[model samples]
Target: MSSHEKHDVETSSGHDIAPATSTASNGLALKPTALERERAEQLARLPDPDAGKSPEERAEIDRKLMWKVDLWLIPWLSLLYLLSFLDRTNIGNARLAGMENDLHMFGTDYNLSLTIFFISYALFEPLTNTLLKRLTPRIFFTGIIVAWGIIMTLMGLCHNFAGLLAARFFLGIAEAGLFPGVNYYLSCWYKGSELGARSAIFFSAAALAGSFGGLLAAAISKMDKIGGVAGWQWIFIIEGLATVFVGLFCWWMVFDWPETARFLSEDDKIRLQRRIIQDRQGHAATDFDKKYIYEALKDWKTYGYMVIYMGCLCPLYAFSLFLPTIIAAIGYSGTTAQLLTVPPYAVAALATVTVGFIADRTRWRGYCNIAVVLVGIVGFSMLLGSGDPHVQYAGTFLGAFGIYPTISNSLSWASNNIEGSLKRAVAIGMIVGWGNLNGVVSSNIYISTQKPRYLTGHGVVLAYQVLFLLGGTIFMHFALKAENKKRLSGARDNMNDGLTDEQKLVRGDNRPDFIYTT
Candidate 1:
């Protein structure tokens, strides 16, 4: 049986939309404001573009627009995430460069340092994303990114374990909200059908950054003997400075939403927004209150996704934090280990794009996530079970590739299953937030005790992967059973609304039949 079941999740609870007043069918929630209603009604009254251009011509234009937005947006967002990910994980590279010798961090203390970052990172996730939504991503995100970059750079000043721990804590605090915020921001621009591919593209930057960091560390570590600073210090100084500069570039370059992007004319903004409403079957977001979060939280799918993502992300971050260490154990010098780290990330970049393409072509994310895990099973098993160093390195590719889509599909799954603006926002934020707590487990997964072989860590990874597989399977099975409530409750009658895309903006995406996606 197919493990990823999607039902007609068509309503946003606590966001009551009287469908009788709705002018759209996108299953979005209705806003109470009279001005919003007037706008929807006015848009409904406009002449249809199909009234003039042929369907083929319209599609061509749409394609061009999507390409243009994707071409510019993917690189910029990817760059931002790339720097963030690199900064977060470069400590692994730092460790390989004899930083432990300089800082005297030999024990579980190193793991504690990594774990602290996630502690701060997990606590503030929803708060950060909420700020992004409330304040607009442009101003809010740039501030956080710059703060983290500066913190990451100052890490070079650390002389001992205590100093490193403080830097790591600040780094985590500064970086906490970015991933989830980017995920939420993407939801506004891309619809369900196209989001997974773009998500993969955004993540590919992170994948490439890992590879780039390794290469960079190899070159910079060689500089350690030259300067009074250690190799690890050079990694922090160069990479941290690079991140600050890139953050400024991203501030200038990133275009947040269709409504406000400078590149889009006023008409184009409206057109893009209208198109999105059309694609979603109505308005994607209608501002609702706190009751909305409570209602969305009631769904079992929310918790199920939380568990699966937790399992998946645990191993993902573990590997990200320890790849260079793992590579060094393969008997290479620090420089060679850095070079060796590139292949796994390179493979991950390929795997992400390939899996994303396949998922989109088939419109199948659930199984695609499953497939990714299978690769992890193979990869990590080799890393743990194989005695041969050459064979163990091959496992890195599998591990990284498998973990990449866990985020992609989980977020895509949220976008697909959840309906209405407030519910969608809360659900996505919570999922991303909860999933990150898995990073806590990951931060400590590969301890100094398990070093050399890392068998215990690999064993933990396999167990978590199995847990994820079972969770994904169960979520699909019963989620559909839950969706049946809408048909039974007579909610569909209240959900019959007539809203063209423009009509939906003012009249609202009033519907009640939606259940959370399984």
Candidate 2:
């Protein structure tokens, strides 16, 4: 017998067969690899975990289990982010409600306050996410919320520009974990395909917070000098206290990880564990390891994701922080401008959720982002093109509607494409943290002197949206497509399939079977 034939026949009954030189000819179209054949046979022989149960019985169990998890998880998680974003963006609302007047802030004091928050926020994110890995989610997440809530309350008491800066800086430190932490946590529970929609649900709360903050500020501004406090003070105190209350309640409500969830039955837990493993195609890396962080840092894709994220965030954060101010500059001021901020955010909240659902369903994250960015480009163009305030206001609607969805889409895309817990954690932290540094650039762009038209600010944002952002998105899309093609056409088995479970966790996205989700 030929040596190759002898090698294959000798190992035909086992897994470690010699590699095939080419397909066995019998006119077949595709030749199965030894690993693929072995896997298929093993699956055929193994009993299903739910083998004895009827299809109806299994379906009913799955329905109840999913409903329980969904109900207990999404609402409170969304609420946590809602509060986090409210505390972050309410400063914009407070500015018009006499915060600047009461603190004697002028020129760039307001800009400095906004810029300083993002600096501390960006600096602390990676460390905070790493801490979430070491500490239990329950302890760490609730603690940060309480801490930031306290800082939010203290903002009400800041009597000077320095005091306000101090409050904002600490608030950033406290809030550093939330965005990345939540993204990591969701990946642990949901399939990669599910992340886009789930992230949308989480992010939509931030948009809603902007709307709520606007309406709340308009109402609270009327409470000026109520008791011994200014309306701006009331905004911080009321919102902060509400956040603290919710944070305390989350201690009881939040689920840490599926394996640790007390509410799920043993069968449901096993099923969920199996489903998550299958969803990742055995590539999900759950173990805590420093190597994963190194892998993320070394990967060129990490920086690519970061650049795209920064492009999106520059405009998103700037718009969120300055929408009220921008509206006021467009000839509406006081309560009317605050009220005007409401509809754009409301529209954005809905548009973001819808796009998220579609992105998840279609698995078209890059395309969706490009589409939204295009919409934002149009919005910015209209804002720059128009001499009319009403037209500029309409442009705000398009900008909010577009950019908010892009943030959720891009975020979910990163979470979906990355594998390994630590790698994902590091990637998310770097992308969000570094991306937010653009907020410093954005904060300074809308100079007080250029108010009303702010031609320079609009032009700069337009350039970023059209140039750097569009370029990053297109490059990533093609890069991921090329990588997927290589993997699909290659003959190798999953690189870590022969390794021990512990080694498999370490291998992460390096596995040959793993395909990048674009």
Candidate 3:
């Protein structure tokens, strides 16, 4: 092959090439540009932790490091998330404990209250996530938890609808940072391939919270008329106080970043950073940049993931917030309904973690996302079409199982594909922040008048599930695959030709060397 043809072949193979002398198309000898030389040097300096280690040695090192990280990180984060979720959704339990009657909530008042929380939540998420880099996870997470916990305690003291609405709105603002913030934080520590299972383990806490919330509410409701407060008030006061304690404890427990984590040795930190850099195929810059935020906003893939997230999240919020009411309508008493919510959430927690492990092992997040969504579709279909109470109850288990896992898969997939730390942070915030607006839709659809057979709510959730399958999951899968194919075929080789090394790093996932996870 001619020299030009060889260069083409090398570029097509995704190698960086900056020849000192090369014949141009006009047969002129061209010199390497300064930027090209600089980029080449930067790539040469990129660390490889496995440089001299055997595969077995590397595996052993990884095993020990991961166990240490998981032991210190996942459980504490999961515990905090569990408390966050419990505090957020316990209002559903509160309603069953006669909060509505006590507060004199009229028709649509309760739904409006739920809608207001998500409005604040959706609005604040992106801003909060951006601040996370500045504040650090340790301070950011602890501050938000304490803020929300206080708001939740105030919620118990609400005597009227206005007080309830005020508390809920502030609660939204405070809690908005936790979910997306944790997702971004995890990306800092884990490679793209290892992120799914860890994310699943963290998120499964929401499912566990569901189970715990049900049981806690059931037992806490028995504190009726204690201190002259209603049972519903006790649920909030007790759970909220517990949350405050956990938040305060997080100050001592939460690690800021892998680099700063005191739990890891110097060698472990260096090795971990090298592994992450290698996974990105470049440096993982953490500095804040307006351009990174703009890139995330402009990227079509960010919006695509947001839509997919909404499809899953709508059903998730609807199911969690209304499960007690739905069960009560199916011949169970109020307390019994609260207790019944536990089993579905227990099953869901197990399924979520299991599927997360499978997705990581097989590296098939898209397929797993699609499969679980399909399960949820079958579940909602059963609920909509069947009149038998047994079938409808069984459907709840399927629904919980399917919906909880999809959030983990989708989050990991989005984070896996994005390359820069700040850029991924912005993208996660946008996806989760905007996606949560569906909570408004969920709150309204299950109107009290539609109690026994909430056909409208079931039907809407079912449609969103279908959209998740078709529009979000399938579209993203094919689009990412096609992009990868183009990159592999050298179509993007010249796309960054004129850019400086700094500019190219800022291009993030759009960089030709970066591959999207489908």
Candidate 4:
């Protein structure tokens, strides 16, 4: 028998099977290309990896697979994020526990420390995200988490302002990868609609940590003088140790790609991969190309998302990092102010998850974003208009509810609208990295000298809400609608008329088959 003929042999089941290469309609030999051959082999190896499965069966399989993915992945990522958030914002709690006097932070030193952390965070975030895919999610994420955890623990050892500043700067570098990396990783698994709620659940851990951190601080503050440590030191020591432990645990738990998930059957893995490809409509679904990075950089929507995200995060971070201080400034003092921070964060967590659920189900992300920002506008107006502590406290609740929802919405919105994995990676990273520069703005806006009302801070945040409402909500909604219309009108058919399949794949979102989601 010829080598090709031998390759076509079948089993005793009597099914007729052709060799890998066959004849085309014009009688030329039709051999599989490298990409096609790899895809075919991947499908063939997966147990029962057929699209002919019944809808009911497919649904059942997908449901089980999603549950498994969620179970294995979500808890660990959320826990790590919870700790990341706790460590990040715990400086406020530490301040309440006497870190300011211990380290002799004066004037704008505290503000500068916060500003420096964000500067390092913003500078490193995109670089870390670009490295994440290359390093693999499991190693990159766990390594950064461990690094930050160690930095956080060592914060307790810092006896001077310079020591705290250095620790915070490095901590920012270590933490830059996590939040965006998790978002990029989720885009690998979930569809556009599924992303919002999942992102919310993941992001909500920050608020939960804030509330939990308050209670933890209250308890830990009483531990002053144990092992020659101050109460603030204990707060960092205990929380940082907990974060390190979670990071170590997650090292073995995180799955970088769906196909590599050990908990999944071969058939389940194939289906998981197929579902995301279908969801994204073949826009950079499975491969990485350097051109996608350049394309994303040139895309205007990337920066638009970044600006809107900045608007949202400015208020969110200000609120998270200074709620205790804000409360203390409003006449509450000692642990009472620390305890008061819990409610706003708790309320914010509830608001965040609820809106995320609604946005996913309704698919009204653009409108949802606008509506939430308006709620914050009202909150900020109230804060600016009132002098009553009770009224100000109510405004805090409103502001918390408004800002927290936007984190998930804006994240999922960017992830939803951008196509192609590498493009999305750069886009998400840029959005997050650039947006967080607002942290520097936020850190400075609430100056100690401007306390009691901080009219400038409230006014600045309110103006941002209006800007996002106009640019991010109204403009993006109409722009996406116009683009989708242009694509549907078949106006770009001439551009790809002579292109091969491989060339078309290279077009990414510019492909006629691609439609931008609003």
Query: Whole-model lDDT for model 1 versus the true structure?
Result: 0.72
TM-score of each: 0.85, 0.88, 0.89, 0.89
Tens digits of lDDT, candidate 4, 216-255: 9999999999889999999998988888888887667887
Candidate 2 error regions (>4 Å): 1-49, 54-60, 283-288, 491-507
Q: How accurate locally is residue 441 in candidate 1, as Cα lDDT from 0 to 100?
A: 79
Residue-level error in angstroms, candidate 4, position 411: 1.6
- Displacement of the residue 166 alpha carbon in candidate 1, Å: 1.1
* lDDT: worst 10-residue window of model 4: 6-15
Error of 4 at 93 (Å): 1.0
Best by TM-score: 3
- Decreasing lDDT order of the candidates: 3, 4, 2, 1
Off by over 4 Å in 4: 1-53, 283-288, 492-503
Q: Could you give candidate 3's per-residue lDDT for residues 1-518 as a string of tens digits?
A: 22111111011111122253456779997775433453344336545556799999999999999899889989999999999999989999999899999999989898999999999999998887668766788889889998888999989999999999999999999999999888777766776677788889999999999999999999999999999999999999999999998999888898776667899988787666545444444334445668877888889889899989999889999999989888888889777889999999999999999999998887677899888988888888988988789999999999998799999988888877765566777788888887898899998999888878999999999999997644799999999899989998889889888888778867767876567777
* Two-way TM-score contest, 2 vs 4, winner: 4
Which parts of model 1 have CA positions greater than 4 angstroms off? 1-42, 45-51, 225-227, 282-288, 481-518
lDDT of 2 by residue, 394-467 (tens): 99999887688988888777776666656777787888888888888888788888878888788888888887
Model 3 score (lDDT): 0.82
Candidate 2 or 1, higher TM-score: 2
